[model samples]
Target: MNFKEQLTRFPILETVAKAAAELGVEAYIIGGFVRDLILSRASKDIDVVSVGNGIELAERVAARLGPDVFVSIYKNFGTAQIRQCDLEIEFVGARKESYRTDSRKPAVEDGTLSDDQNRRDFTINAMGISLNKDTFGELVDPFEGVRDLKRKIIRTPLEPEITFSDDPLRMMRAIRFASQLNFDIEPDTFDAIIKMKERIGIVSAERISDELNKIILSPTPSYGFKLLYHAGILAIMFPEMIELLGVETIDGKGHKDNFYHTLQVLDNVAQHTDDLWLRWAAILHDIAKPATKKFDKKVGWSFHNHEEVGARMVPVIFRRMKLPLNEKMRFVKKLVRLHLRPIVLSKEEITDSAMRRLLVEAGEDIEALMKLCRADITSKNPDKVKRFLHNFDLVEQKLKDLEERDKLRNFQPVITGEIIMETFGLKPAKEVGIIKEIVREAILEGIIPNEYEPAFAYMVHEGEKLGLSVQSTGTTFE
Candidate 1:
């Protein structure tokens, strides 16, 4: 098919063709831009490969575009980028790569366009559209990438084993692409990934995490993860998660496979929100079950304190996985710790006091917590799921009512430690904390209104019970 119409939408192609003509370089729009165009996928990033100096061609293109445009040159990599409007156009000389077994870094040298296409990670991405004046927009699908695109298959342009072994990260990329495109990994490609799976160890944790995040963000992440598991890359990369696999039985009591359950929860959360951290919370919500698993004669299986343990594990896991250790990590940790709270509330009678405590604890994260809790209902019985959802609605209503009345979302006691100390004619000591706790609990338990006068009266009464006298007894203790 003539891709002439597609080129018209991107007028920059004409400028590139003009630049290439002036420089006497054969240039083509290659790799992802071509693949996405063929698939009719909208892409903002355009990659152009030329037979001569890519940087020189980029300079010429930038000169033609004039001064307002921004062009960035990376001389070491022999690549240059130009930003026009919202589009990013990357220029690189066509090159071939050779890798040593110990590293993924390729020894690069300029070569023909076919050589560059041969090095692409997937057949679909190896296709290119020529930009030379005489052949402008003519597709050069040397490997019949369009046929593979129609087949919805992930295949390497070259032999799968050699393709993956040259750069093991391609194994992860293959699976990531399959997941993102909902394509099947060609059988030989799948087997090659398994064969070269051990080579993934040479890849940096950051690179692996990048691919993993892409998988996690895919419409169905489980597909990529399952491929990783079968290919044995996951075990080498994330053993802690792999540990969540399998069910162990003792005396006819067994626990559900936490691995599969985590995936189900991940998928369930995926269906609701696209927030990566929320989905991460789902993946980790039951992460500690294996560690906390126990069997009792009365109860078949129990995972006591899994939420707390999982919360504690989040920082270490994030650190190891090269994920952010900032607020995103803290958010995941908080959700993992509190994931069971809403479910417990749902199982019981929804109460204002309970909701007040939840609101105060969850604070601004209450809605995210609710989304997680609702996603956690993965029971096979449709009625059971419906019941949990209905109860969760009551719990949500209670939270809203409590928050509106008490203003307890992230609420702190109106009476401070300094107030307690000064009122009781004392220094900062254990008694101050005791008084603050009493006042806070009184408000939470509905023993007194959260207003200042009622809390002050209740605080004085609690202090008197502790054999402490307030200097301002002219007000009298309640």
Candidate 2:
């Protein structure tokens, strides 16, 4: 049961022990570092807890480690952090915390190591390894965190209700940990989460979004979403997503549950790529289905233009959740807008012109869009899924061939409005626009090569048809 051998791997732990012994303080490596060490997960953030002044201990440790080690101290929080050898070691005094009902912030007071462990959110993180000379590397696991680690269950170190209620953000952390480790939430702990779901409102949106991102990055994000939904957190924090839940039947016809469909798409996308924004695209691809839904005797149920509608919703969601509204937001929006195009193309015949427009619009994101489309094919019928995938293969091959032949992506027709204006002796008029559109369409439809010569010739012809004769010859615009 001695992890002293394992502790020797990090020389900094020894330096910390030496420093704490000099200061007559009890020091332990606690929280995530300990949990990950036992689980064999790679972790660089080390949480160090000492029963005496943490900042002073860290300063002494930094001095003992040598001049190269720099310690940053936050006096208000009674914490110190040292960045050494590509690792971040955070130091804090052993303490207990009591919180007000309106806030997650705790009134902290110095306490024993046991009190500190009791204040931890989950059992796995409650385990600590002493870093004192007397007991260097002896584990202090009062909550049997080793058993929970072996069981692969996430449970509170204390009563779940009190643990999560003290810091509602812990509920989000619990779900995130379950998703990341592919572990189960203990029934009582989960029930406690359901009982205290409303407490999450006191937590900040940014914190919730951080946990949500971790969940989305998990191997099976659907697990986190399902837990959030069933436990009522999603309804409180993400009502829009919750609205995607249920199917309404009219005249005995019900549409597929868009909520589960979204989760299936999310899982499928997760299997293909670890890109967080792409996973978000899958989450939001049909987000507007509920809003755009209609029932018709002819079509049973329809969610027409959900992609476009959903794309518009992305910015609002991002703004609300405090997610970046930069190009990342645009990427997710673009994917959502184009998610159905490839699917529709697969269902119908794939055409060069359709592929050209898609290539031009999707530009650099065409591949990501196609990946999302394939993941969106979540048919319960295996044969139907296979057929759609095969059709998608054809569409993909066609795209590759088109891109290889024409280099149509990010392509503008060689004929430009400025050239049309100079050649046809016109200002920026309807004739110029007509000529440009005609040549652009001709190149896309393969009526002419994407080269300058044919496009210029076609532009002249279109201009002549518009009752304008070429007054001067001009070079094609770049």
Candidate 3:
């Protein structure tokens, strides 16, 4: 197949062709760039495969591009990359690979373009468009990649087992591509994933988590997760999530399958926002249910304090998954802990103090927390869903109203520990912390406005109760 018009759209390909011709080597725009071009997906990354040294080709292309352009070379891997404005083009030599039993890293040797395409993980990604002057847009697809693309299938060019076994990370990539493009894996290929599920243990946690995050960010992320679950990959990669799979029944009552519920919540959050951490919160909001589940004759089943337990589990899970344990981790943890607070408020009489406390605790993340909570409503009963949604609207309105009256979104205590220490002429002690907490609580409870004067006055009174004499007046403390 020729895509001359499409190839013409990227004038940089002409420079690549010129560079390859000067080096007297066959070069083609291959892999993801070719796949996305056929699918009409906008892509900024281009992979160029050369029959000779890829670094030389990159150098020539860079020189042709201009003096300002820089080509980054990795001689050990026989690859080079050039950044041109918004576009990133990578150059690599066509090579045949032989993988060891223990490692995914391949023994590389320069070969023909056919050898390169044969090693591709998926058919759609194996297609390449020649960059020669005579065959400018000719696709070299021995594996019928275009047909697979038309059929919307993910199939390895080589044997599925061999492909996945050679680089087990390709198993995750297969599922990721299927999820990202909403394509189906070929039956044989999917089965191969199931058969090779254990091999994924060889892949690093960072690589696994990277693919998992991509799956989470997909339009319908639950599809990818369901694939992982069905293939048994989730069992090995994320046992915590897999533990949410089945429902336990006692007597005539049973709880919902939390695994599917989590997927539903994740899908709902995906519709509202693309924040990966928010979606992560949805996945983990009920993660500790299994640990905290208790059976009672009257209540059937209850997961008491699962939210707090799940919040504590967040750091451990993130560390295990090789995800960053920074502010993002804290964000997920906070959401998990407070996820039930708004739902509880909606079921009960909404209070100003409750709203204030939620606002104060959630801070800038209150809106995100609300989105996650809204997504957590996954009941099958339409009436129940409708009633909960209505209550949520009411709760949101109250939050908005209260937030306007008292700007508590970024609420912090006006009285600092330093001020407390100054007021009592005390060093860093429990008395100072106690006074600060009292003032903070008073403001949050609306007993005193979050201001310097009233907070200072309350701190002074609290100091007296704690048997700490106020050595200085309000001015001195202020």
lDDT of each: 0.90, 0.91, 0.93
Candidate 3, backbone clash total: 0
- Count clashes in each candidate, considering only residues at least 3 apart in sequence or on different chains: 0, 0, 0
Runs of candidate 2 exceeding 4 Å displacement: 424-434, 467-472, 476-478
lDDT of 3 by residue, 134-183 (tens): 99899889899899999999999999999999999999999999999999
Residues 90-127, candidate 2: write the lDDT tens digits.
Answer: 99999989999899999999999989998999999999
The sequence of per-residue lDDT tens digits that candidate 1 reaches over residues 1-478 is 6798789999998999999999999999998888898888999999999999999999999999998877799999999999886899999999989999898999999899989999999999999999998888899999989999999999999999999999999999999999999999999999999988999989998999999999999999888889889989889998878999998988877777888888888988898889999988988899888888888889888999999999999999999889999999999999999999999999987777788888988999999999998888887799999988999998888888778877887788878777787789988889989889989998888888877788888888999999999876434322
Clashing pairs in 2: none
How does candidate 3 fare on TM-score? 0.98
Name the candidate that leads on TM-score. 3
* TM-score ranking, best first: 3, 1, 2
TM-score of the candidate numbered 2? 0.95
Which is better, 1 or 2, measured by lDDT?
2
Of the two candidates 1 and 3, the one with more favorable TM-score, higher being better, is 3
